[model samples]
Target: MINYRPKVFDEASKSHASKKLYAILLAFIVVMGIILILESIIPAIVSTKPMLEEMNENGYLENPDNFNFQESMKLAMKVSSSPSAMIPTLLSTIFGTVTAIFYCRCIEMRPVRSMGARKEGFFSHYITGIITGIILMSAITLLSVALGVNKIEICHGVNYKVIALYLLGFIVQGMSEEFIFRGYLMTTIGGAGYHTGIAVMISAVAFALAHAANPGFGVVPFINLTLFGVFAALHVVVFDNIWGICAIHSIWNFTQGNFYGISVSGSNNTESVFRTTAVSDKAFLTGGEFGIEGSIFTTLILSIGIASSIYLIYKRQQLQQKKQPSQE
Candidate 1:
């Protein structure tokens, strides 16, 4: 059975702010932080320690002292093989986002959007999302180059299936994120009496902070992700639908994992990325070995993508306005 929650009535198009909403959001942040910390620790306690000891005994990891923390951390992220990771990842995507949004709703109170006949087409969602991705990736890539940071490298023998899964994860993650941050969070805060700009800015910043635990998450990544959040909001403005944003995100990520063959947010998987060539070693230019999305080439590509998406939206809006019959 579905649980329904009704928001309080407000005469204005905007709704009243609820103290409860902010409280719930705060708690969500705290819990999420705790979980990330625990995940980091558990790997060392169980798998990492055991593997290192075995390696020491067998000489595979010959030098215990020389055991590179970064390399071990990479293995730790791969705690479970590709197939197994899906279970927890899916659960987290569904349960985590739902739980957070529900809690937020509890404070603000509202109905979930109708699950009835869907309004938007999948292609619209996918294409818009791809445009967003291209813009973002290209932007970071170019910025890195301008700043003397080239973070790209070509690799052979990519893992396609694993890449698919990774991209799927991004889709799930991106959709859930957009819903919570843009849909729920944006409405909650905006209705609660905050300016639209404030609400959007806060939500974007929050979204970036949420990923503070990712592998290559740094100032650059954080700023990039925040920009991503803003870009997502713009998507909502243009389409008033989630379809495009989700599609673009999924494709963008898949392209990275399958075509580029690098760690998505710093975690490796069983996937074959066709392109494997580093542009440089500077973090500023090449994302400093973090990922190509942070490279100069990606930056240039993103700039074009962003302009294209915007132009499409504007053109679409004008056409729709023109198509409307004149009222007598």
Candidate 2:
């Protein structure tokens, strides 16, 4: 029998699937959904961070009745900004960890993991992440070229230090998202059932839809984002862990935004270490309105991602099975 302990309801130390698992998932999704809908209606409902309210309480947002569109956009963006580190950490532990423990109540997982107090560490799985990110970025870049939306000029410049810094920024961006989504969300959902297909699909959907509000919203980007979800879910199934996928996501974004200097998902990354000027003609290749991620090549890359994830997962399973009889 599989031994699992989700810290949601049971007082006993004995391992058993928590009865509250489904109820918890359903309730949280519904609540999050409602909150999102309300946010669309009233911008102030957007983020849980109190900073916006504090700003408004001060003269930062006085009689906005006299403000123009740009001012309004700034306010709207502010409402959705991230919270202070202390608050987010408190919430992640109280909320994010709880979701992880409960949502993935299906799998026989460890009550405590090697991921420690810092909530981060040396990415042992960093290599796999970089490969995955590179694959995705390459595909997107190729499509950008074909579409003529923008062109890229690779720098053979002697400024290797700038290039290195740019790459590091990319790594951080990919790692952060991967860690949060694939690592955090995936393992949490594993408790429900680690080896099953359904758990993976759920994670992927969550990953994709999270980007719905990004500046460029068309069918392709949405589809691409959904594919990202699928990619992330499958990635975790391979290692039965989250570290690799996090690095991939952070690096992927960093590369797309910083190094390429092309619009990343339609948003320009002027803050990136390297400044890249647009260099293409065909909007289709340029990914036109949606950015490189909006291209069909992105789909191909995702297909590869899906295949790689499956292959890795199968190999891991085989290794585990091979060890099982020896233990016996």
| Candidate 2 whole-model C-alpha lDDT, 0 to 1 | 0.53
Worst 10 residues of 1 by lDDT: 2-11
Predicted candidate 1 versus true structure: per-residue lDDT over 122-202, tens digit per residue: 675577568766555545444554555434455566545665566666776666666666666554555555554565567
Best TM-score among the predictions, by candidate number: 1
User: Local error of candidate 1 at 97, Å?
Assistant: 3.0
Q: Write the per-residue lDDT of candidate 2 for residues 191-284, one digit (tens) a residue.
A: 4344346545665666667767666667777777778777876655545455677667766776776566556666534333444443664443
> On a 0 to 100 scale, what is the lDDT of residue 27 in model 2?
49
Off by over 4 Å in 1: 1-75, 78-91, 104-107, 114-123, 127-160, 296-328
Q: Rate the local accuracy (lDDT) of all candidates.
A: 0.54, 0.53
